[model samples]
Target: MNKPERVKLFLVDDDKVFLKSLEIDFLENADFVVETFPTGELCVENLSKKPDLIILDYHLNGIEKSAMNGISTLDKIKAVNADIPVIMLSSQDKIDVAVDCMHHQAFDYVVKSETAFMRLKTIISNAFRLKKVEKELKWYMNKM
Candidate 1:
């Protein structure tokens, strides 16, 4: 018998308390090898880790106000590996923003709410399923 492999997840948020809480929640309950980053730059720099999923915050409250927001970060991540799934998170629930993220191929856009962690877990599972299916489809197509 062999243990199942843990999912590699990258979580990026500038809010210190919120980020810490999310880190603890996933570490406690999920079979994820989680890496937390305070800024999109840090996350992008570490993209070589090849995370299975990326959860990024729309608003980065870091010292550098010009740092990458979720959209730009998503673009950068896609540039690195278009196959990787990215979920955008924000306290703001603007329809336009969500639509824009969807246009850029975001796996999901989640508003930060009391039930955010639960929603995150659900989205993560769905994204992984989709990704796996996509990979298998690509392989099958190539074989034909």
Candidate 2:
């Protein structure tokens, strides 16, 4: 019997309190290894580590305002690895914004709220499963 590979996740948010809390929630699971970044710039800079999934805050505040926002971060991540799934997070629940994220290939868009962490966990699990299926399909296609 062998343990499954742990998923590496990058959580980028400007809100320190919320970021810390989310990190704690994700870390509770042994299957997930969550890394926190205060700015989208930092997250993009560390993309070489290749996180399995990224949870990015849409409106990165303060100093981060001058840096990359969630949409740009998603673009950068896709440039590095288009297969990587990025979940966009925002405190504002706007359908247009969510649509914009989806247009840019975001895996999902989630509004920041009390249940955000729970939603993130579910989305991450589903994303990983979908990724596995995609890889398997690609391999099969290459074989044929």
Candidate 3:
């Protein structure tokens, strides 16, 4: 894929170590341009910096300024770009919360598991694949 065409991935999580590791993994193994934020606010600020797929953790470490919740962050993000695909990841198995997020328009919900990172990779890949098709269709339509 063209370097410019690589999917841009934004990560919002409290865990710095984990986020960094994920960045390294995506850089080395996946067809993504990864940007990870240790807090939700920074991620929100960077949304306009670039736009693509997003991976959000349910519980963030510093959320007081941001209402300290993933859903709130999601709301803020959607305010800016509703069509951006966001995969919400939570260690908690709160069905209600997941349902609420979905109702609010989350693309997908994932509970932390043994291979959560791998699952994230799959989700990103699938989303990008679909986006690629959509882009091609739009181009063809414009040409026609």
Candidate 4:
């Protein structure tokens, strides 16, 4: 018998408090290895670590006026590795914003609210399940 690998999650948010709280929640509740980034730039710089998923704040420039926004960072991340799933997390609940993130290939968009953590947990589980199925399909195809 072998132990399963823990999921590696990269959480990028300019709000330090929100980021820390979310990180703590994930660490305490899930079998995840979490990394917190205060800026999208820092997340991009650490992409070499190859996190399984990323939860990025839509408004990343809140703390830094000149920082790259979530969409831009998302683009950079996709450019580096399109396979890595990224969930756009934002305070904005507008449909247009969520649509924009989906257009940019976000795995999903999560609005900041009391239910956010639960929603995120569900999304993460679904994403991983899908990824596993995809991989198994690819393997079967290759065998055939």
Best by lDDT: 4
- Per-residue lDDT tens digits for candidate 3, residues 51-108, read 6988998888543545457887888889899889999988888999789889777888
Which 10 residues in a row give candidate 2 its minimum summed lDDT? 60-69
Residue 89 lDDT (model 3): 83
The candidate with the higher lDDT, 1 or 4, is: 4
What is the model-wide C-alpha lDDT for candidate 3?
0.82
Higher TM-score: candidate 1 or 3?
1
Which of the numbered candidates is closest to the native, going by highest TM-score?
A: 4
lDDT of 2 by residue, 1-144 (tens): 999778888999988998999888888754688899998889988999988889998887655457777788788889989988999999888999999999999999999999988888889889989988998999999999
lDDT of 1 by residue, 13-129 (tens): 999888889989999989899999999999999999999899998887555688887788889999999988889999888999899999988999999888999999999989878
> Candidate 3, which segments miss by more than 4 Å at Cα?
1-4, 61-67, 133-144
For model 4, the superposed segments whose C-alpha errors exceed 4 Å read none
What's the TM for model 3?
A: 0.81
Query: How would the candidate models be sorted by lDDT, starting from the highest?
Result: 4, 1, 2, 3
TM-score of each: 0.92, 0.92, 0.81, 0.97
- Give candidate 1's whole-model lDDT: 0.90
Q: Model 3 clash pairs?
A: 63-68
Comparison by lDDT, 2 against 3, better one: 2
lDDT of 4 at 129: 97
Candidate 1: Cα lDDT at 72: 83
